[model samples]
Target: MFEKLSYLQLQQYWWFLVGTLAALFVFMTFVQGGQTLLRELGRSETQRDLLVNALGRKWELGFTSLVMFGGALFAAFPLFYSVSFGGAYFVWMAILFCFIIQAVAYEYRKKPDNFLGQRTYEIFLFINGSLGIFLVGAALATLFSGGHFVVNEMHLSRWTNPLYGLEALANPFNIAFGLMLFFLSRLLASLFFINEIDDEAIYARARKSLLRCTLMFLAAFAYVAYAIATMKGYGYDPATGAVFAKEGKYLQNLLAMPAVAGMLLAGVLGLLAGVAMTLWGGSRRGIWPAGIGVVLVVLALFLTLGYNDTAFYPSLSDPQSSLTIQNSSGSRYTLVAMSYVSLMVPFVLGYIAFVWRAMSAKRLTVEEVENDPHHY
Candidate 1:
């Protein structure tokens, strides 16, 4: 069944898979967001412990999802993996360091003979939650805002900027996108706490923080929306397949693909509905819808960047060198063979669900953390 499709169809299918995995990774960032809330939402030592243990139950999922997303890109779109990871080694190294410290913090924080102390580990988690997530957002922002890399006829790429990927931080739009993602993670984390902790104190604090998180998220969302609507976007001639810049190209893409536009609108509404359900309707399952909303919104944005003959990775230094799905994807045989493997994705997702349900079968509490021998 997978062998008969044209090369473009296989490319689209694999790109869709990549986008789906990316969305899941973004949704799982709630764990990172919750890490930042350890001190802010937890008033006492016991409360902090509760937050830690609850988040600890799931942090691996987020980290693992991120790794899977990267791996998928590496396999399905090796050129992008090479160009971005190779050219932007500094930023990737920083992100890798942050996550490494996070794993260390969780493992060593509760160990009896740890010399660094718990506070140091907590700080490490905060850095991973904040700076690590921010850098990811800034890096992704280059998809829409464009990067400073150039590719030659031989398909080799180089970062024209000396700072490598760190230069993305210099772009105001990237900064705003990073901030937006950071706050969204926190917002999702708060909702997760409200639903899963079953402690009134933590619930109250988490609920209270939602207002500020919503406001901050909305402010950043507004800026990003405006920027996307107005910025000159990278595109290619569908007829000629030549990359170039065009004003309001994102808007054009959205309009050209109404289904994507619908997804974006539905995603926005789902997010708003989740917040409303928590704040006014008094629901505990806001995170479910909110998480789904994050996935859809992110997926829609990714589609807008990649589809409609648009360049998913634009090159500001050399416009024609931009990376598009047509140019950067794996070979036809590679994609067809991998498409068969992609069928296993459903079972993988089901297994993830099973493990998640098993791990979270019982709501976390101080008593549970106190008694559990393996609590983080």
Candidate 2:
């Protein structure tokens, strides 16, 4: 079935797949968000244990999804994988270190022979949760705001600036998106805690914090959206396929693609519904709506960045060097073969859902954690 499609069609299809994976990954970051809130929500050891165990059930899902997203990107768009990962080694290394520490923290936090002690590992987990998600979001922001990198004739990319990807900090738009993701993840975490952990103090604190974080999230999201809507965007010539800067390019893309606009609207409404229900409706299941919303919103955002003759990865030093889905994707044979393999993704997701349901058969409580023989 994949044999008949053109190379451009395959590239677009893979972008859709990548966008979906990224959206799911963002939603899963709620595990990190909950980690960041461990102390803020927990008043005692029992409450903390409850929170940790609740988050532990889903932490691996986030990590696994991240790996899959990267893997899929590497297979479908090797040039983007090489350019971004090869050039932004420092930032990627830091992000990887954060996740590695999180893995260690989870495994050893309750182990008897753990050398670092529980508190130290918990601290490391908190750091990993906060910084890791924020940095990843910031890195994605570079797709629009541009990054400092150059590609040679052999398509090998090098970091043009000494700071590597850290130079992205200089872009306010990128920072805005980063902060937005941080607060959004935190908000989702709070919602998840309210549903998963059965603690009055934690629920109340998370409820209050969710309200505060949601407001901040909206503010940051608005700023980034506004900037993207009005700012200059990279456009490619249909004849020469050469990239060029065009004012209000993103705005045009949105107008040109009504389906993306509908998705964005739906995502926004879903987010608002989740937040409002969590705050006012005495609902413990706000995570469901909000989590879905995160996926939809993030997917739409990625689509906007890559589709409609836009440059998904732009170059600051040379605008012409920007990479689009067409320029960066792999050969048609590779994309077709990978597309066939992609059919297994739904089965994986189904298995994950089954595991999630089994683990969350009942809400987490202090008594359960204390009385249970096996605890996180």
Q: Give the whole-model CA lDDT for all candidates, comma-separated.
A: 0.90, 0.89
TM agreement with the true structure for every prediction: 0.98, 0.98
Worst 10 residues of 1 by lDDT: 236-245
- Clashes, model 1: 0
Summarize candidate 2's per-residue lDDT along 303-355 as a digit string, tens digits.
99889989999898887778899888898889999999999989999999999
Question: What is the Å distance of residue 103 in model 1 from its true position?
Answer: 0.9
Clash pairs, model 2 backbone? none
Look at candidate 1 and give me any clashing residue pairs: none
- Cand. 1 Cα-lDDT: 0.90
Clashes of 2: 0
44-136, model 1: which lDDT tens digit per residue? Answer: 988999999988988988998899889989988888898899988888999999999999999999899799999999999999999999989
